[model samples]
Target: MTALSEYERLEAEGIWRPDPEAQRQEVILSLGDATLVIADDRSATALAHWSLPAMIRLNPGARPAIYAPSAEPGEELEIADETMIAAIEKVHAMIEARRPHPGRLRGALIGGGVLLLGAVVLFWLPGALVDHAARIAPQAKRVEIGRKLLTEFTKMTGQPCHSPAGDKALAALAERLPGQQVIEVLPEALDGARLLPGGLAIVGRNTIAGPDTPEVVAGFLIAAQRGAAGERPLHRMLDWLGPAAALRLLTTGDLPDDGIAEYAQELVQHPPERPNNDTLLHAFREAGVSSTPYAYALDPTGESVLGLIEADPFKGQPAPHPVLEDAQWVALQDICSAH
Candidate 1:
């Protein structure tokens, strides 16, 4: 009963010492059932039975390794055999695996409870339950989902533009923005801005770089914050994917590629409709941003978006602060080129 069947015949030579005062002697070394057997080389008489699990190498990673039966004061052996040292380490690892895992049983019970609860909820109200799951999903989970969606969207959108300096600059802007959104720039794949789950927004490269001022881009972002009377993108995604996708996300913390593929395609193909003017103005006012720049950006003449131009929120007085510094805007605009 050796540590392993393959190592049953493994043997090596080593020098052994019976105790601190005993003279060193050459010995025959061999592996036994969970033990290291030391024998008198001349007589072949077993002299020691060192428990493999209790063995400790005093000099690790050096030639002629020194080993003691345990940490306590005891006899020691010096073996330059790499094979035996590896086998001993493997036996220790096996013993470690057999040790009790703290809280494993408790964790399993909690996970089972969660799965059972999710199942019961799905059985009752499929649609409503899915909506609730998406709405209440933790921010970290939503961020995970949103990042995955962006990766998938790249199949059609190509890669989103990113560079070290640009990403740092964009992150700074995101911190100051209303939703603290992760905004990505996609070249030509999108003509307008669209929101994803979590606080992620994707806008066309042209939309971000072409605008004369960051306020125009900021308007597009604030409008995407609340779509068509406050129905967020999370709800829209669940509705499109149906209850099955939502339930899967809640239970498994992920969605299959097939489940989200079609929606990702649809999202890239059809950009979100323009946010209502009243809602847009309200968002602008709340975000401490101007709407006229956005209106003029939308219609250079400001004829079609005259209502937004007239009802501009930051019109009467100066803004508390600009949307972004001149340098930050330049860095963000340079993302596509740098990438």
Candidate 2:
């Protein structure tokens, strides 16, 4: 492995006890491509060779780590050297990377054939084809689709709000979400939040402007994440366009610009689908944000979103962390204003 090349023939002094009954002895630990060679310090005689792939860290994240061969539990190696421990961890990661992923090959084979056939079957069996395509399409393609959709979406909603301070605040807010997905704020035309294809999320200007606390914005972001988890954006897109367009996307990696533009126009006018209250509450809990603000924002009367408020994750307690700083929230509120 290329990762091993950097530490070729690297050796270190380590205390290796042969067994539970034996006293610890200083051993010369030599790094090998596939094995760790332990030798007697004085005589330079080989003691034991541990397979790199089979080595397991016993005391993970400890100062002085312990390791043993996965198969041979009777023997143990204690290592106090940080460099040696880091090397072993790196080698383990490299070996794991080489192992075959269970369904990757099968998915690739199926994905290759599905595109053309999926397009034809889309007219008669839209749901199945869309689900299959959404499952099979690679992450890169999903990102591409999301970007294209955003471009089209911008046509109807206007350009995303961007000021130097606002951009920084937006980025900080995005970091709170899983994967640090891009969160774009639209000046108008959006009712609330929508998760785009890939990990992108879009929110309306009103969502930020209407609420006094950043918790509401954070709650909406978590709700968008919950909605995206419930339904993949690619599946939604394919359902909107049908088989022929999906086939074109599968084969050529693009959809008609006109179709995307039209869809964007329709999407701007409609609010994104809301996830069930339970799912949203779970999301809010995970993000350490209260659902009360979002609940009241959805309905000032608090009648429709009573469930969210009643089952609020951080109800009657302080949040684990503030969603945004006071300054950041102020910057975010004036995102559309010129710097």
Q: Local distance difference test, per candidate? A: 0.82, 0.82
TM-score of each: 0.60, 0.61
State candidate 1's TM-score.
0.60
Tens-digit lDDT string for candidate 2 (44-124): 999999988898998889868888877565778888887888899998888778899869878887887797677766555
lDDT of 1: 0.82
Worst lDDT run of 10 residues, candidate 1, spans 223-232
lDDT of 2 at 63: 68
What range of 10 consecutive residues in model 2 has the weakest lDDT sum? 1-10
- Candidate 2's C-alpha runs over 4 A off are 1-125
